[model samples]
Target chain A: MKLGVSLYSFAGDLQTGALTVDDALRYCAALGCEGVELIGEQHIPNWPNTKISDLDHINDLCKELGLEIFCFSYYMNALSHYDRRATMEEHLEMVRLGAATASYLGTRIMRPAFYGVPVENMIEMIKAGLPIAEKYEIIWGVELHAPFPPVYYIDALEKINSPWFRLIPDFSCWQTAGAAGHFQANDVETLRPLLKWTVHCHGKGHVFDEHGEEPNTPYKDLMNILKEYGYEGAVVAESEGWITNYKPTLDVVKTHFKLLEKYGR
Target chain B: MSVELRIPTGGSYALTEQFRELGERVAFPDLNLHKVEMDGMKGYEFKLRNPWYTEFPVSCAEDMEVGINGYAVQKGKIFFVIRDQAVPFKYAKNLYELQWGLGEVAQVRMLDGQLQAVVKEANDVEIKFLLRTAFEGYHLPNNRIEYEFKRNMGVI
Candidate 1:
């Protein structure tokens, strides 16, 4: 499987001006990532209103940096807006925009989430996006989180089961041993069956000790599961520990890289 | 900073009369509002801080202060609660982070071609914090408040 980091791991740092995109790329390469994921909202200047040239510039930069831009994270939710139909229309346009960006970024996979909407509704929304996705050769994948169960999308996947639809399994769904019941981060056993539909992964990392100890998340176990499934895709080091503490956030992110080195195939 | 409380015209969340009846004065505090501005949804990433609140957009550029505490939901009713120091606002960052992005807490949905915000706070304080600066730093007020083109009371 290809290994990488989502620049979002540096969100706090990016917000604080501690990390620059250029340095982040070098940092990812230093950590031995085979590819990388991009968060458009944080990275793009004009963002949703970005010009095509800007997309081309980023794509060219990634090529020169030798970083494979595996996926562009585009989020769409049919339920957030007041008008579901208006929201649907808005997302249909967003799909076209995302596909255009993905085409320029040199990646064929775009990760769009189903936020606060039912599985059927989310699928219906995704169907609206498929025509554009096919046009750009970008595959639309849903990240499996506590809120988004993989099974929920199964019926829809079967109905329009094109190679364009896929899943981005976030390891946070695999809770740490004895973390908290409230987190709703799933266990490996529950997620094992969902692997068949997974195409990419977000190695959501958190809390690492100085002794190279295992953090709350079960990275090793998750890596093994991915291996068992013969999965080959980008594993983005997506961490969130930076929010609370200014210190040790990078340490925790580093731990993810270490764990990946040890267990990731 | 004071926020203009717009009354619900007509819905299950009609909160105009309720907010006008609020006998308590709402206080304000430093808050990080979560607001999600729809720009075709530029991107998605799970922030470890608070996933539930993540969808809501909060701006460092915007001041975290408010004149009123915010809105609350009790037994299926929405109320404007004052942010009193004695009764602090409940920062459910942890709960919001854990409860699957807390989709049930303060949501936006469709009703008769209109977009309405639906919020279900666990407690009065949490709802206040939510409304004042919870997600977008605003709440449901049941008072008839409007500014005319001349910036005055009811006029033609």
Candidate 2:
């Protein structure tokens, strides 16, 4: 499995103007990351209305750095309306836009978080965007976050059993420690069944121990499970320590990469 | 020596109490508020941070109230600035096209003469608005959550 870093890990720095998008990509490259993930809105200036020139510049930069753009994450705010949720057409348009951006970034995987939207609505939106996904040669990886087990989306995944539709199981789901009760841990074995559908993954890390290991997540077990299932996709290191513990993101991200190197298969 | 009985009421507990009190008054963080010049009018500008993980439209902002040093500014005097276009706060609800991207900075500028008194080097700022989050309002009573952000920040 290839190890990578998500630009979302440096959200704090990006928001504070401490790091530009170029700076972040270079930082990931310097860390010896073979690939990187990006959140469209976070890294792309004037996102959804993104300029082709900017996209081309980013593509060139990644090529220059020899870093693969593994995945581009998207967020859908279905509740953007004041009195109602966004229409199906609106959501589908967003998907198309996201897919276009992901295609331009030279990434085959797109992870979208449909927060506040029902699963049924989410499925419908994905189904509507399948043509766009196909056209862009992009795969949709629905993120499996905490408080919800992998089984929560099994029926949905089975119903829409297309290669284009898959899962991106976050390590936070298998967290045995460090969440402080905000999330419930799912048995590591539960993820075994969903491995076939997982195209990408989020290696969510919070606080690191003195030994440069994540105290909250079982990285070794997670790596073993992915390896056992023949999952060779990129495991992107995503650090939430900046938001949770107020730790410097650069420091936490560096430690996370080391932890990934130690356990990443 | 006689032992003096002392009630421990300091450290984290005191700090927590102070925060609780401050929480009731402030709406957003100090870093989000800045003093800027817009249209040659010098005043304070407050950035609207997407409270949720995903991006939402600026139209979701409703019933906004801005307080500077304990004085509330009239809604007519406030403007919601996104993409360099400023719309009156009262009419922001009709702007369905203005999307506030995640981690993107959108400003609420109070540049009228009314703010001249409080828009100084350092001031107390408070912003309160009801965020119509999905269908939470339809299912629960008074669940159209009102977000309150407050900070005593340097505006220079």
lDDT of each: 0.52, 0.73
Model 1 has a clash total of 17
Clashing pairs in model 2? A1-A265, B26-B149, B26-B150, B27-B148, B27-B149, B27-B150, B28-B149, B28-B150
- The model with the greatest TM-score is 2
Q: Which ten residues in a row have the lowest lDDT in candidate 1 chain A?
A: A77-86
Q: Clashes in candidate 2: how many?
A: 8
lDDT of 1 by residue, A90-197 (tens): 778778888888778888788765452345676677777798899888888777653334355667667778888887877766665334211344557766787777
Give candidate 1's error at residue B15 in angstroms.
Answer: 25
The Cα error of candidate 2 at residue A152, in Å, is: 1.2
Docking tier of model 2: it is: incorrect
